[model samples]
Target: MIDVVAAILKQGDKILIARRKEGKSLGGYWEFPGGKIEEGESPEKSLIRELKEEMMIDIKVTEPFGENIHDYGDKKIRLIAFWGEIDSGEIVLKDHDCIEWVFPKDLHQYNFSPADVSFVEQLMK
Candidate 1:
């Protein structure tokens, strides 16, 4: 199974969400910004690294928010999510096609990745 980490990055009352680039896996689906956890790295460390590498932003990972295991026909992933806040740097789009800051109640408007749906549900509640 692929091990992944995601950040519920917050700015005031809004949370950050990124859309996968077209032609990529889960293309056009929105997700919490993060990537696969490298070997030997803790989930929090992985999230910090991923946010930097993908979005060019440093984050302070706070508490664990939730986790889920999902199968997408050929691939299965264990996705771990954490509450986080951006600590520094401007946001840059390297891996994603677009990004948005949205209120939790408005998250339902975007089509999110299946693995990320659980986190969205938790946030909306």
Candidate 2:
């Protein structure tokens, strides 16, 4: 399975979510901002690297939310979500189409990746 890490970054009552760019896998779907866990890197360490590379922001992981595994026919991944806060840097979108900071209660408004559905449900509970 493809191993990935996602960040559950919160600012006030809203959390950060990013949209996948067109032409990419799961393109046009929303997901927590993060990327794959590289070799020799822990999940949290991978998250810190991904957030910076993708969003140009620094984060300190506060807690691990949980994990989910899902398959989209051609591709499958195990995503680990974590709770974190911005440590530094400006918000820049190096990847993804755009971003939204939304209250979790309203997460239904956007189309999220299938792998993230469980994480969203757990957040609601």
TM-scores vs. true structure, each candidate: 0.98, 0.95
Minimal lDDT window, size 10, model 2: 116-125
C-alpha local distance difference test of each model: 0.95, 0.91
Best by lDDT: 1
lDDT of 2 by residue, 2-119 (tens): 9999999999999999999988878999999899999999999999999999988999999999999898888889999999999999898867989998999888888898999888
Candidate 1, RMSD to the unseen true structure: 0.7
Each model's RMSD to truth, in Å? 0.7, 1.0
Q: Give the top-scoring candidate (TM-score).
A: 1
Kindly report which residue stretches of model 2 are placed more than 4 angstroms away from their true locations once superposed: none
TM match of model 1 to true structure: 0.98
lDDT per residue as tens, model 1, 1-125: 99999999989999999999998888999999999999999999999999999989999998999899999989999999999999999999987999999999999999999999988998999
